[model samples]
Target: MTKEKFKSLMQEAGIKSKKELAELMGLHYGTINNWGNTQGYPTYLNNYFHFIIKAKKYDEALKKGFDESEKPQECPSNVEALSLENARLREECEKYEALKRALKEALR
Candidate 1:
């Protein structure tokens, strides 16, 4: 999502900053900032997008007086969220690998 949309999500969720939202949604502070802007690679960007979407869905459900525990949650569960985060970490690793290859090429 665009920075403005992400910011709007934060507002709609009734939070002030990424840190607060992170705490509320159990997301890493960095993940929220990554959503705010491109951090490095857009590898797991979709995961964050899905996460925010799910959170919004959950919030909407609550507002609608739905019982979340008995209902099917379209949002990413804990495992799914972790899996998405793993994709992000893998992307970070790839960047380092690319840098390493560049260094090796330079030495050659």
Candidate 2:
């Protein structure tokens, strides 16, 4: 989701900030903001909201709980997408390292 839309969702759900949402999914602060901007989140956090919804027994139940002076929540899909993106970024870094090693070997 776009940052604006994500921010809107938080507002509609009565959430305060990305930090709270990230904490709900056991993520670092700014994780949700990054996900909203980049369309990716952590895999472990993917099913976080699903669990919360199931535990609460309604789509908005968790939100309601949060609205009632509790904290925010994280959704599974967002977390999964972000995890994939993070893995992809890690792989890219590995490739860069390999290329650097190869270049050093050639120069030597």
Clashing residue pairs in candidate 2, if any?
A: 40-82, 41-81, 41-82, 41-83, 42-83, 46-76
lDDT of 2 at 102: 100
Model 2 worst lDDT window (10 residues): 68-77
For model 2 the TM-score comes to 0.34
Model 1 misplaced regions, further than 4 Å: 39-108
Tens digit of lDDT per residue, candidate 2, span 5-106?
555555555457778777765767765666845666446443554454455557567567458345434455567899999999999999999999999999
On the 0 to 100 scale, the lDDT of residue 35 in model 2 is 81
Q: Rate the local accuracy (lDDT) of all candidates.
A: 0.70, 0.65
Query: Could you tell me every candidate's TM-score relative to the true structure?
Result: 0.34, 0.34
lDDT (10s digit) by residue, model 1, range 1-108: 566765665565556777986686687888767754566424554465567678888888786655556645644476698899999999999999999999999999
Off by over 4 Å in 2: 38-108
* lDDT agreement of model 1 with the native: 0.70
